[model samples]
Target: MSTVYLVGAGPGDPGMLTLKAKEVIETCDVMIYDYLANADFLKWCKEDCEILYVGKKGGDHTLPQDKINELIIEKARTGKTICRLKGGDPYVFGRGGEEAEELVEAGIDFEVVPGITAGVAAPAYAGIPVTHRDHTTSVCFITGHEDPTKEKSGHNWSVYGQSNSTLVFYMGVKNLPMIAENLMKNGRAADTPVALVRWGTRCEQTSMVSTLENVAEDAAERGFKAPSIIVVGGVCSLHDKLGWFEKKPLLGQGVVVTRAREQASGMVKTMRDLGACVYEFPTISINPLENADEVEEHALQLGRWDWVIFTSVNGVKHFWQHLRNAGLDARQFGGINVAAIGPATANALRDRGINPDFVPKKYVAEHVVKGLLDLDIAGKKVLIPRARVAREILPAELTRAKCDVKVLPVYETTLAEESGAEIEKALEEGRIQYVTFTSSSTVENFFQLVKAEKVQDCPHVKMACIGPVTAKTLRDYGLTPDIQPEDYTIPGLVQSILDDK
Candidate 1:
């Protein structure tokens, strides 16, 4: 039987997408997505999956409802799995029910996947809880605009006005005056609280709160437009105390994360969720090795070494890159030593079908040296293949202890040239709220790509360096480090920012 899946794409953020929606998007041969659906969500699709954009923007749908239904049916009939991705819950204010009816008439097999609806999600993101113990127990969610072509039907606003229930209206900006008037006529208090939230989940979210009597005027003063929702009743009063999103220290500030584009995903996602605008600017690009000579040389000499050290996941990745490039397997390191400087780097080795022989309790290079010296390596060999700019402390320590150390520069760190314009633009416009320096080279290389005058433009922006070394490097650029974490991991850096905030 032909099958179709009606999936909710969540609010604007790609991270908000449901696991089922992500799974369906990956497996489906065809996908029809909404205009409000985030473009990043489409990245989950396989390389060959057919994607059709059937979005509705501001009530102007690119494809008519009937045409969308016909397309789904046609796609399913071809014996391919079909996915219909919609913004928010597929059924809430969406024409998903109507489309489902057509699918049923066409005898298509289908399933509905519910999503975090924007009506509720947006308010939560703004730190306004719809239901609180002290707040009203009942909540009403109604469309602000009925079919404009139809005669406006009168709803008894008095029931909602007299009751203590919270009232939430979707698509309500167009009928703000009428909604306020009806509430006032129906016994709603003139001073009842009201709030308008625009572009709720995304970075562009703006909100204004006022009493029911003056909400329309307040919205007008703030230039509130459609694609915004209205929340009325006493819960709207809690925004000041309960508002969390806007309270982020760097809220609305724009910062650029300069990790490699592939590796930058985690940092970019974290910063954006913390209520800051993030631009991706990769400072370094990674290229895999083309041959197995390096991997074979290290693997074949493994048994003679007392410790084999990996400092970064990229080091582990590139090592494996050479291993695969040379057609060698994990067994090549038999009886040889394995050590990782950090937990993340150690895990990378475990993921690739081998366990690290030794991992330092502390993740620093000094800790790795201490751990290695404690081992039996009086006449042993140690292989340390790492980034070119790594500190020589480890090799120097091993040699002083009378251990033979073979050092190979498997990867060279070069200044990335792609970040010139973006950093300058962000600096000139005063958009950067934070610039985190993870390594001394990253600090130096970033400034090398961008000129000295441009770097000085963002003097007031908060600067975070991962450690004392990176912090010193920032001082050379004529800026002081405002936040430096005790531990230099990415998560530690984020926690430091949160703590200082």
Candidate 2:
């Protein structure tokens, strides 16, 4: 029989999840998640795993506490590895104790994986230390949500108000006025600094600072909502000097990445680290050609060619694979001069122990042709390994220079049929601030998935292309790119977005 794991999903950021929690999630056969848990974590689950949402938001409950407990027990009886994923530390006012007790009574084996509570993490992300030697030496976590079953209040407001410990309230937005009034009436200073961090630890995090006397008013004025952490103490005064997360240039900006799934990680990490909520909507998928026999045949005849040019990283990778499959290695290229279209393509070749003799200053077909012209290969036999469908300018220009060129297909790029629900919703709500295109293929396929009319309707949504080639592709669809970096690289594109803001 499988065990039921009660896991805590830390705050709102997936990066905060513990390694043990991630392990259990990845191996679990069933996942029952809460509303506050980041949905991004679900991507770690197995393909066939069953996901059930038993989230509770405000007064609305998708499934009552009793029902949730029963569901857990029922799932455990089926002998499947079940993960009951909750938000924050399950024992820190998360009602995890009740679930554990029920599991014990039901004779089910279970384990608890503790997580970082939002009360501490949220304040820290907002630059407010829960405990400091110069401020308070201790900290306390409290629930602002009152218990209806209790005949009287269990909390001693006077003791809490007079204590030297820093106070953190969970789910306190609705009762902010009452909590503040009680604290002040019981001896806490009305001028005490307080900070409210909403959507804490995530890219959309925002913190508001106010005095205890006017925190409720300030929160209302600024439109702060639930799923927020409230910190009340002298440490809150340090928010301005120590505040960092919200100050990120693209903190709340939403960007859509149209790179292939395998190639999207670097760009995703780059954008996300800069505090942009990245939506990976890959419009193209790169795959090796159906038959690499021709590529393998050409690779075996590498010594016969005077020049071998790789147009992309994909070309280098696919061609290298074919070379190795044909019982050959980089040593076979010793008699041939190699050229790469860009530094990335050159680096790929270098990784395979074959450094290119030429890398064009400009990453384009025309520049590749110009660079090859300077090589003085008028009668040289050249081989070009690249995508199945691409511009013929390079090969045509080389042929015009009196060189015999053989164009070999090493890989192919095709449109990826991915669900557009998330992108559509983001566009409909005007939440997508930028759509980034890394290549002409990404630009063309992106327009295929998302109609040009819909993109034009979202006034807040702007287009960002990696270089002039991609920008030209956007222009072909009658759409002008709002941001294009001078460097024409991933980092450059991100910098352009930051600069535009």
Among these predictions, the greatest lDDT belongs to 2
Worst 10 residues of 1 by lDDT: 286-295
Quote each prediction's TM-score: 0.74, 0.96
> Over all chains combined, what TM-score does candidate 1 have?
0.74
Residue 70, candidate 2: alpha-carbon lDDT:
99
Candidate 2 residue spans exceeding 4 A from truth? none
Q: Tens digits of per-residue lDDT for model 1 on 1-501?
A: 657999998877667888998999999999899887777777689889999998777678899878999999999999999989998889998778998999999998999998888888888877678887787887888888776667766456778667787888888897999999998888888999898888887766778789989999989988999788799887888888777767666567676676766567877878887877776666776654444466567755566666677878888877776667567777766777888877678888899877987887766667777787788754578888777667788888878888888876566666665848867887888877777777777788777787867766667777788777778888998878899987777888878877866
Evaluated at residue 146, the lDDT of candidate 1 is 79
Q: Kindly give the stretch of ten consecutive residues in candidate 2 with the minimal lDDT sum.
A: 362-371
lDDT of 2: 0.90
**Cα lDDT tens digits for candidate 2, 1-501:** 879999999998878999999999999999999998889899899999999999877678899999999999999999999999999988898899999999999999999999999998999889999998999999988888867789998778998899978999988899999989999998899999989999999988999999999999999999999988889999998899898888888898999999998788888998888899999899999998888888888887789999999888889888889988998989998878999887788889999998889988777777778778888876789999998998888889899998999999999999997877779888998788999999999988988888888888887889999988889999999888999888767778888999989
